[model samples]
Target: MSPFDPFVHVIDHPLVQHKLTLMRQKTASTTSFRTLLNELAMLMAYEVTRDMPTQEIQIDTPLETMTGRVIDGKKLALVSILRAGTGILDGFLSVVPGARVGHIGLYRDPTTLQAVEYYFKMPKEMEVRDVVVVDPMLATGHSAIAAITRIKATRPKSIKFVCLLTCPEGVKALREAHPDVHIFTAAIDRQLNSHGYILPGLGDAGDRIFGTQ
Candidate 1:
C-alpha cells in the first residue's frame, strides 16, 4: 500500500465528471443539485475507502465452503461537520452502511472569523475507529481545522477529511493544521470570493441543497 501523503484525491471518474458537469451549470435545479451531491459523495467514498483494511472470512456457498472478505480490524466512524456536512453524510452512509456516525456543529464566531462548537457527539471508542470528518465546501478551512482539532481531542487512531469542493485557502489551512489527514474532493476551485465563498462554487451548499436560499 502507498504511504498516505498530504493526500488529496479529486474524483475524476467518468460518472462523477458527467454528474459534476450538470451540477456546475447555472440552471441546475436544487433537486438535481442535492441528488448529484449525494450520488457524487457515494462514488467518492468508494475511492476514499479503497485502502480500508480487509480480512479473510470463511463462507459456505450453496454447495461448497470458501473464503470470503470481511473488514479487517477497526471499523469506520464518520464525523459530519454540521449543516452542510450533514449533506455529505447521507451519501457516505449509503456506501458505508456499517460505519458509525458522529456529529459536530460549529457556528462561525462573526467577530473572530473562527468556528466555535456548540454541539459535539462522537463514538465513545473513537480512538479505536477510523474517523472521517466531512464537509461540502472548504473555503477558508477555519471551520474544518477547528472541527479536526476537537475530533483529535478524542484521540482517534486516524482521521480523514472529505469535502465536495475546496479553494486554495481551505486546502492550505487543512494542510497546515492536520497534515496527517487524507482529503478527498470533487474539485478545488481557483480562489475564494471576497466574502470567503469559493469562486464558481455552487453557493452555500446547505442553503442550495436544502432550499433555504
Candidate 2:
C-alpha cells in the first residue's frame, strides 16, 4: 500500500539537479524559468526513454559487413496535460525529434473537485504509439489520472507519466487509478495543503509560468 514504492523514479541526474535548483529560487527570472524547464525536461526525457527497444540492420559502407541500429516499432507520443504541461513539451520533443504530440485539457469542478475533461487532441494513429503523459506538477493527481484515463481510450502500446515535482498524495492517487503507469519525476514533495496545493510546492504552476499573479 506504499504508494511511493510502485513505479516512481526520481531522476537525479546532475543536469536535472542543477536546473531544478535554479527553478526553485526566487531570483530565477521568468526567462530563466523557461530555460530551466526546457533543460530539465530534456534531461528527464533522457532517463525516461532508457528502456526503449532498438533494432539492428546490416549496412555496407566503405567497408563490408557493418551493422547499424535504429529504434524498433511504435514511435512515441508526447501528451501534454495542458497549460503548464506545455512548458516541458518542446524540450521533450527536442530529444525525441520524431515523437508525436497530443493535448488534453481538464478542469476541476469547484464543488466536487473532480477533474472534468474539456478538450483532447491526439495524433491520427495514436493507438499504436508509446505515450508519455506530462504535467509540471503532480499535486492532487486528479487531473493526471483523468488525463491518463482519457488517453487510455486510444489503446496505446504503453503509458508513462512524467512530472517535474510529485507529491505523496498525488502519487498514491495516480497509482491507484492507473497501476501500470511508470512515473518519472525530479522530486517528490510531502503532502498537500487543505487548498489542494502540494506542500512547499512552487505555487500554481500555470500562474507562475504565465505570470498570472
* TM per prediction: 0.92, 0.91
Cα lDDT of model 2 by residue, 55-161, tens digit: 89998888678888877433889999878898888889888888888999987776776788888999878767999999999888899999999899999989999
List per-candidate RMSD values in Å: 3.0, 2.0
The lDDT per prediction is 0.84, 0.85
Q: lDDT tens digits, residues 1-213, model 1?
A: 122434777777898878777877768888998999899889888888888888888999999999988773338999998888987898988987889999999876766667888999997888789998999888888999999999999999889999888877888888888889888888878898777888887777887788786
Per candidate, the number of residue pairs that clash is 0, 0
Deviation from truth (RMSD, Å), model 1: 3.0
Q: Residue 182's C-alpha lDDT in candidate 2?
A: 92
With a 3 Å backbone cut-off (N, CA, C), the pairs that clash in candidate 1 are none
